[model samples]
Structure formats: structure tokens, C-alpha cells
Target: MTTSKKHGSNTALVHSDYQAPEGFAAFPVGIHHASTVLFKNVAAMRERSWQNKSAYTYGLHGTPTSFTLEARLAEIEQGEHCLLVPSGLAAITLVDMAFLQSGDDVLIPDNAYNPNRELGDWLARSFGISARYYDPMIGAGISDLIRDNTRLIWAEAPGSVTMEVPDIPAICDAAHAKGVLVALDNTWSAGVAFPAFDYGVDIIMQALTKYQSGGSDVLMGAVITRDQTLNARLQAAHMRLGFGVGMDDAYLVLRNLPTLKLRFDAHDASARKVAAWLQTRPEISKVLHPALAECPGHEIWKRDFTGAGGLFSVLFDARYTEEQTDRFVDALQLFKIGFSWGGAHSLCVPYRIKQMRQHWSHDGILVRFNIGLEDAEDLINDITQALESLDA
Candidate 1:
């Protein structure tokens, strides 16, 4: 700033027009949080539109923090647009609300996340929408179930607890033939291990609460898309729902994105190790992991996914009582019994197989594990000690 001798004391501080100097460079983008954004004038306000995304309109529409995250996520997912939502479940809800209407049918894999099925059920019975469950391995056979009114098809690569990997490309091919859009609850891959857009998925949602944050401290979800028209549908529903993510949470996810690959590799390697060891145990009748040869859709997984995440499920022999299963799960010290993955602590959650799936049948109790960043040997030791409790 050039100073004038005549305008002396405090003039530079108060009256100088040298505000917002140029040429400053920083690594992280500034967090532009605001409910009210001031415009240069009324003309600029009228010209600023939220549809183009060239600029921000309000905090609900978009902010620098969110815009950066969205652009980066879209880039990573091989998509053209991205929408950030409050929670992973909310992201699922947003897609469900946007696509399906009364008298429309939505096809979901029988092994989808339980809550997603529940939400679909509510959206079905309460409203006029209908949902049908199909085998995860249905593949192009999905054509059998796709009716004239089918609007959306939902798939989860490796079925949540069952760990059945679907033939996604084939399924997408069938979905598209019928003019239906395919959506995936891709939390297992974090939209990293699998390329959603490349594989023919129309829209994919990620529960950033699990993997993206790289820490369980934040809760967020993302809806990434390649088609502008489909993205517009999601954008409209998102706005009407008034879904606004916290700037702090968005920044937290942005900070963690760089470390996602490293953490995911650690989680994948550790999970494979633990799953392999568990397969050797006598009490485990079966190990449900996508990478393993015994998993239902291992071949499909091998064909599609680049790598598997830290989550997998195992079945205790039918000889073990429900109480015994609980005893074993409760015995673990290092593997905490809880839901959710991609955190520092390993977790376990037992599921009643019969209640969860309609097309598949299993004789044993199912226990899912989220392998965390702990040493593989330590995690194995924890599992070995816990299995001893089955005898108790």
C-alpha cells in the first residue's frame, strides 16, 4: 500500500483503500461459512445462481468448504457432480425420496444395509412407493424382477453382513436397459476401492461417517453422480429437505481425504489377515469375506473391485447357542462390540441371519467385524481368546 505524507496519523489504518491484497497462496482452502452472503450490488445478487455452481448463493446451497469437497469427491469418484448430506442414512433417504414416487417400484438387494431396507419399507407402505428384494447374485437375471414401473435399483457390492458381492456391471446393464437408474450404498468401498461411475452406476452414496472422515468423530454422507439431469433431481430434493452439513464436519472430512488411501490399505490388509485366520477355526462354519474364495460372489468381486475393505462377517456353527455366541462376542477385549467401521477400534456385531435375508439361507449365527488399525497379531489373539468363551 502506498502512503501519502499529507494524510498522516491513522490514515493508512482507517481510510486506505488497500484492503484484500493479492498474491497470497495457501494450501487449504478458506472455510467460507455463512447463511447470508453479501453481494457487490443488486445486479450481482440477481446474477448469482445456485444451479451453475460457478459461485455460492447461501450456506445451504454451497460454501467454499463444501464446494471444494464436492469437486474433489466428484473427481475421485469419476463423476461430474457431488452432493454432501448430513449423514450416510440421510444420503440414502435423499436418493429414495428423489427418485421414487407413489406407484413406483424400487429394487433392492436382499442383503442391503438393514436400515436402508427399513427406510425403503417405510417409504413403501407409508407412501405409495413399492420395494422388491432381489438376490445379490441376480446379475442380469435382475431383468426378471424389473417391472414397467421400476424407477431405481439399489445395490451394495458386498451385502452388508452377508458379504455377498453383486455382479454390479451386469446388474447395471439390466437396470439401464429398462431405463432404471442404479444407486449403490458404497460405504464398504468408500467410493475408492470400486469406481462407481466407471462400472455403470448412475448414482452412488457413501457414508463418510465410516471411511471418509478417517475418524469416527464426524458424520457425513455424499451423493456423487455423472449425469446432469440425475444430479438436478438430487439437488432439488436436497434443497427441499434443507440438508446443510456443518462447515466444521466438512472441513474434517476434507482434511482426512489425503490419508484415506493409507488408512484403507491398512484396514484392508489387516482385515484379510484376520479373516484368513478365522477361516482356520473349527467353530466358524463359514467366513463371509469378498476376497476369500468361499464368499458367494468372490469371482464377481475379483472381476470388479480393486480391493476389499476392513469389514467382513463370520458364521458360528449352529451347535453354539445364542447365549454362547453373545458370550464369545462379549469376551473380546481388543475387538469392541459395536456397529460402524473405518475407525481406530475394531468392532463386532452379531446378526440373526434368518431375519435379515429372504432369498438366502444360513444355519449359523452371523458376527460381523470391522478390522481397525491394530496389529493383525493382536487382533487375532483377541479373537482366539474370545472364541474360548463359546465353551464357557
Candidate 2:
């Protein structure tokens, strides 16, 4: 046994050099949790570009574990660069903080994620950077909203809880024509089902804690871009925010990536079944699923999105108040009442729609459901039993 005391104190030898094995192989990537990465020499560190991710500078910037995850996410998202953040909203804020500044304006969909709306309503506004809510369906019509100070435009597919799919290509085209960037909150599809770059989207952000983690345990996010120049700005903002993910969380997301497609397909299949069944019931006045024809922009979704995920909403008749919707969600056994989605367990959330949209007109109760990796028949039966509560 080697004793540190033979040469010096244990603490002194603890930081001493010990070479790692050269030839290591594993099916799963090793989690290289690190901080204060050491350099072979001062010159080696001096030559590296931390912003470019050409080499590691420190833990908050990048590590092998995190870089590996970033590369995989970029490849999957069809982008050339990837940056990880602590949460999905963090990614969104990063894009905003990076590109826009005081006196500049950002355009967000009226139905974007509520937190995103709050970002504009509070932080962005407080900073003197303005955010204007635009109708997502405006598509090429979005050009009218552009101003000389418009630095960025935000788009959310199937805008938030209402599930109204937007014309992404048209919106992106308009933004590009005005020399502005488009950032899409692609958490709904996990950046897989809908190809953001294909539609000319400059940046795509995903909540990896969802489908990518598959456990509902991790809360990580990623921002991907095909342009190196844009990513440089994003990386700078990310560093400023001191955003980083846990090694365990990164490993969990990495391990689950292989099963993402399978889980996504299952969730899609089951959700369609539930959505279709809900359409037939007297309780549901409308089913706002992108896969379904009745949903606004369904044709555009069919045209652009290769497939849809399990997250969607339903409009109950005016007779059923918020109280009724709450009862229905509570009565659900297999589908737990919660927020956020993309997990093994199904979830139900009641959306407050009074202030979410500007163009849509709906006074009925809105309920969102996240279908999980459960049997379609079993989930349908669960809904059937839960619907009974709507009557009482």
C-alpha cells in the first residue's frame, strides 16, 4: 500500500499527480464531474478559447460529461452548437439576455409559456428592454410587428396551453427578412418532433428534464444553434449566468436519450387516443391537439411537424366551471395532478386562459394533460372513470 506520509503529508499528496488509466471503455459515457480543471502547462491554458468550447477552462463553462451531452443534443437538434443551462427557462432568458439590451425590443407569442410571458412582463420590462406579444398565427404577417430596435422574436409551437400551432416558417422568414433572430421555446416537442432549424429558426431551446431525462427528476435545459456566431453570444451569456448542470443529472439525461424516440412515440399514440376519446364525450367542448384537425393551425402542424407529443389541452363546456375541472383532474387516478410533463407518469394541469391569449375567444374551462408511457387503453379507462366526477 502506498502511504502519502512516505513522501509528505496526506493532504499535500492528495493533490499530487496520479495518472488515470489510458484505455478505458464503457457503453455509458463516464461522468467527469470537475471544477478548476488543471492544465498541462500555463501556455496550454492560454491558447484555449473557452467561448468556442475548443478546450475546457473551468467547471462552470464545460466538462467532458457536459460537453458530451451538448454534442449529442446539438446533433439530435440538427444544430452545430449546443449550450446547457440550469433550466429550460434559463435557456430562454439566456437568449434574451445575450442578444437584446436596454432600448431593444423582443417579440414573444401571446400564448408563449407563462414564465416566458413573465420574463417579458417583469425582468425584460424592468431592464428597459421591451417585449411585445404578437399573434403567433400571424406568420409572415409578423413583419408588421418588427421595429428598428426589434432584436429578437420568440415563437412557441402550438402556443402554450391553448395548443394553437403557429406558422413557424412564415414567422422565421419574416424575422430573417428584418434581420432579427427567432428563438423558439421548443419544450413541447423536445426539439425532436419539430425541426426548428428546418423552419429557419435561429435558436431552439429544450427542457431536457422532460423527455430527455424521462424520469421527471432532472431539471436541465439546452440552447442549440447552427450558427457559431450566435452560439458565441449565447455561451457568453451562459457564463455570466453561471449556469451548469449536476453530473448525475447530465448522466441521467444521457442514459435516457436512447429511449427518447420510443417514449415519445408511445406518448404520442396514447395522447391521440385520449384526445380522440375526449372529443366524443359530452364533457369536452373542444380538444386542442395539434394532431387533431379541429385544432387551429393543425394543417400547418401537419405540414411542418413530423409528429406531435402528449402535451395538449381540452376546453370544457361553459357549464363546467373551474371547480368542475379541478374535480375532474383530482379524480384522475393514473394521471396525477401536476405541472410540467415528459415522464413515466401521466399529469393533469388546469390552465387559466383568461389572460393567456389575445386573439382567441374561449370562456370554457381549459385542462392540459401530459400522457406518459402508459397503455392507451388503460389511460382511456382512467379518463372514463374520472369524467364521472364532471357530472357531480
Candidate 3:
């Protein structure tokens, strides 16, 4: 009489009675894989809102895994709200689509990350939005470029390969004065070296592909904002774009978060050492490390940044041709030739700066370095040998 109704083998398999103990704990966040979430009752389902992240409505909105990562990233970046995207470029596009509309004008730095610049051009070409490029060094002078329809300004602290650090606070001040929002590609700093919001950046975009993952494996990005209203706009765009990050990737980033600052400092120490040595080299015309006096906006960098990441660029001696630089890059043993940085393996990339920028005043071949976790002396020896290839 008292026994529960027996179910068939198939039904038993589909709906298991077993449940794991509730008190178990672990260091890593549980990887929650779910496309559809169940509710205790119909009333609970009716009350659920995807926008209110306190509860989950669907997998696309987020699971505990993604939400945990988002909260940690927001805390690191000093933002109140955060949204994860598929990639760093996706984060830029999300910001653009969220804020700018038809007849809106946006200002972009000439030396911005190539993908970002390309996205701006595409928006201008297809959408009714107007995207204009401005000098990265314009600073407060940016005020003159703002139009009545200008809605957003994109700033990169140090221009990508060319590495010209801009006056961010001044730019933010100018943009805010015009009631325009400033979005910063803070990927270079990895939220470890720089506090973006403290300096007045309204929106902070990070390429988690770099230091956050630190494994050269995951591709992810985050958009963070302190203003709830602004975050609401971003949430709408995020939903419309169907942006969903893998819970597995989310866990990967979470696993690496504890060592972020430590790794960043190690990279900083090695990079500065390598950059300083390069400055004394006969083959290098200029080292574009922000810590060095030769870099543009070095003073601003000193005033604003607490530290620098492993990334920096070097301009070869004008005497060395592109062929020679290519030879040198090809000969490197420890440093792999590739794009994107922040892994344990050193990387070198050569950029055609003049072609990428509207007004690139630099004269030599621009080569960027991402100093890895290797010993600086060993890396220097590798570079020393590679430099000999320039002669052949």
C-alpha cells in the first residue's frame, strides 16, 4: 500500500531520484550546463526575469558559471555591471550597437586596434551611423570634434602597434562635457594595471582572450559599466545579439583569476627589462614601452598607470628594411610569430603601421613584443641571435 508507484526503466532513467548532497564545496565553480531551467512552480516561472541575474531564466541569459565569472570580472574592473561576449571584437561591436543608432556620430582613435577601426568603418559604410577617426593624442582637444549627434567616443590608452598613449582623463572630461559617453579598450591593461572607471571612463571593454585566460586558449570579452541605466542598454543589445559565452570557458577564466595580478607583475618586470635592453641596442630605433621616456604620453602613463603588461612595440632602425626585420622575426627560436599576446610563450608580430593608421609618423618597421614568463636574460639571448639574421 505504502510503496511509491513503480516507474518503467525508461522513465526512471529520464527522471532520476538521486540527488547529490547539498553541503559539498569545492574551489572551482561548478560548470553549470543548461539550456532550459526548471522552476519550482508555474508562479516561480512567471516571476523569473532574465534581466535580473539573481535568477536564471535560460542558458543564453546565463548560468551560475557565467554569472560568477561576470561578477568577478566586474569586481576586478571596479564596475557595478558586466556582460560577457563571444570575443573582444564582439564586445566592441556590442557597445557600438547598444549606444549608437542611425544618424549618430562616433569618434574613434586613428591608431585603434585594427578590428575596432574596421568595425567603425563598417558601421559607417552600411548603417546610417557616422564613424570618424581622431588623433589619439588629441586629449581635451577632442571637444572640438564633438558634434550634436556625437553619441560615443572610443579611446585606447596606448594606440595598438604604434603605441601612442592618449590622455584618457582629458578625453573623458571632454566627452562628458558634451554629454557623450567614452568607451575604452582597456584590454591592454588587463584591469590589473589600470583602474578605468576611477579615471572617468563610462564603459570599460576588456579582451579576456589575453591575460584573463592566460592560457592562449579561451576567447572572451567583457563590457563593464558603473551606471545601471547604461548597463540596461547593454543588456538589451546583448540579448538582441544572442551573446552567449561557454560555461567551460567561463570556468577557465575563473580558474586563472587568482593569479592575474601576480602574472601581470611578472610580465611587467620582464617586459621593462627587455624594453630597457632594446633601447641600448643598435638595431632598435625606439622602444615604445610606456615606461620609457621615448614613448608618446609617457608622462600620462606614469601619472595614470600603476603598472604595465608584457605588451610593447619596438621600431627597427631605419637602416633595416622590412625584409631584414622579417628575417629577424623568422629566426627567433623562443618567441613565436603570431597575433594576440599574454600567454606563457613569447610572441613577436610585425605591423605595417603606415597602412593601418591615417597619419603614422613613425619611420621604421613596427614590431610588437609580448614578453612571456621566460627569463629576461634568456629571451634577450634569443633576440640577440635573431638580430644576427637581419644581416643575412
Q: TM-score each candidate.
A: 0.94, 0.96, 0.98
Write down the RMSD of all candidates, one decimal each.
3.5, 1.5, 1.8
The pairs that clash in candidate 2 are none
lDDT (C-alpha, whole model) for all candidates: 0.90, 0.88, 0.94
Which stretches in model 3 have alpha-carbon errors above 4 Å?
A: 1-5
Candidate 1 residues lying further than 4 Å off, grouped into runs, are 1-22
Task: Tell me the lDDT of model 2 at 298.
Answer: 97
Local distance difference test, candidate 1: 0.90
For candidate 2, what is the lDDT? 0.88
Q: Candidate 3 versus the native: TM-score?
A: 0.98
Tens-place lDDT per residue, model 2, 82-175, is 9998898888889988998889999999888888999998756489988889977788999999999999999999776888899988998899
lDDT by residue for model 1 (243-291), tens: 9898888999898899898899999999999999999999999999999
> Of the candidates numbered 1 and 3, which has the greater lDDT value?
3
Distance from true position, residue 387, model 2, in Å? 1.3
The local lDDT score (0 to 100) that residue 255 gets in candidate 1 is 89
State, as a TM-score between 0 and 1, how close model 1 is to the true structure. 0.94
